[model samples]
Target chain A: MDNKVHLITEQDIHAYIDGELSGERKAAVEVFLAERDLPLERAARYLRNNFDLKAVRDEVYRDEKLKSEIDRLLARRKPRRHLIGASA
Target chain B: MTNQANTISTEDLNACLPALYRFAYTLTRNDDRASDLVQDCVERCLRKQHLFDGQNLRSWMFTVCRRVFLNQIRRDKVRGVAVDMEDAPQSKLSISAFQEEKMHYQDVVESFRELPHNDKVVLSLVAIEGLKYEEAAELLEVPVGTVRSRLSRARSRLRDLLENSGEEGTVVAASV
Candidate 1:
């Protein structure tokens, strides 16, 4: 994150998005990013991808219809090889 | 049955269902296909229960899911499934009014499916699935550095993809 002397590298961007950068270093990265538009958007989106994906996944899991469908499939699918638990 | 429980029961399989389906979805990028792949993987696990080392059921299930996906891909190729455009998504995704966030979820996940298989695997495991770098590396049988590097590259590539597709998305927010 020490971009004070050198240009912002991909490593700094990674740390910033992961929230590993802090204090002055974090601010410096922000300063470098604020001057640009696309890079900032990309960085923000990258950070949010983690959050967005988790939110979407939670939404999927919370869907009662999908859950019921999967449950029905499980109940209906005959265990042609249902020997594991029985043998054990 | 010790803590490892060499025999994987229906209860164990049930507990692992969500995680397995999630992993399968990351690979197949289709709901029904992912579900079918999970079922196939479950069958393989049950049939090969003696092969289960009895440690980390989720991890083992993930491995099985990935193998099943590969096998399906091979089968599809042999069966002459429709060839997909290298960079073209299977469906047109656009941003519509009042559902920006919902559309965005499809946008992101759809773009994710377009990424190289390795990138999708690494990013899903670490970012979406919440595996540590070492754990992902071990699961993937790659070095920790490789995982970190692939994750970085994957993050950038995913961003690029979303950016590329977002431009095509219809901006219908003004009416709202």
Candidate 2:
């Protein structure tokens, strides 16, 4: 399993996972992945779990207490009133 | 009926506040600190309303918030405030179920947090904020090539770290 990673260059793996490289490079990685015993599923799982930052964003959004504080702050900043009577 | 032209309104801010909070949370990785950061940024933006062109409200707010956070970091440096990555409290979830999964997630976050601050900023901007590479490059004020290199380094390092180590040990310190 140690040498299974030798099938793809690190940069090409990155490009493959990121959907960056295309045409020949893309096909090259796909062909490489097909023959390796590196557990492509596990590699993909690692990438997916590690990169899913939207989950973090959702956690931050879930905090209702924080939402209230932001709401309060926004309320206090309700813009200054216009001066209607002074036209020099 | 509300006129959008007269002044900044609560509705506009209300819509903006969530994104601001999310960005601040990603930047600071601490809920309370991120909230404070967002509050400060919004207040500053409101005070300088003339600077806003209404051309791209979201990007403008992001620029303002990012500036405010960076300014705070700079000021904290003058006061000698040390931001220790190792000090972030571990999640309190019981490790009884899916212990490996929980550990892996923690390891990833720690590894990410360990990256240089600039790297973290770009990673979060693209990965978390869902910005295009071009948009992230613009946000970081760097060339697209620089963005690609940093992101490539960051993701590869993360993969290597995850693939080569104990499941429970903290790599955040080493990665940073």
User: Chain A TM-score of each model, in the order shown?
Assistant: 0.53, 0.46
Q: On residues B97-116, what C-alpha lDDT tens digit does candidate 1 reach at each position?
A: 22343556678767776777
- Native contacts retained by model 2, as a fraction? 0.11
DockQ of prediction 2: 0.06
Interface RMSD of each: 15.0, 14.6
With a 3 Å backbone cut-off (N, CA, C), the pairs that clash in candidate 2 are: B114-B176
lDDT of 2 by residue, A1-88 (tens): 1224334665555555554556555555654643342533333433453344434444433445533543443344323245233212
Segments in model 1 whose C-alpha atoms lie over 4 Å from true places: A1-6, A58-88, B1-96, B131-144, B164-169, B172-176
> What's each prediction's clash count?
0, 1
**How far is A21's C-alpha from truth in model 2 (Å)?**
3.8
| Cα lDDT for residue B67, candidate 1 | 64
TM-score of chain B in each prediction: 0.53, 0.52
Best by DockQ: 1
TM-score of each: 0.43, 0.39
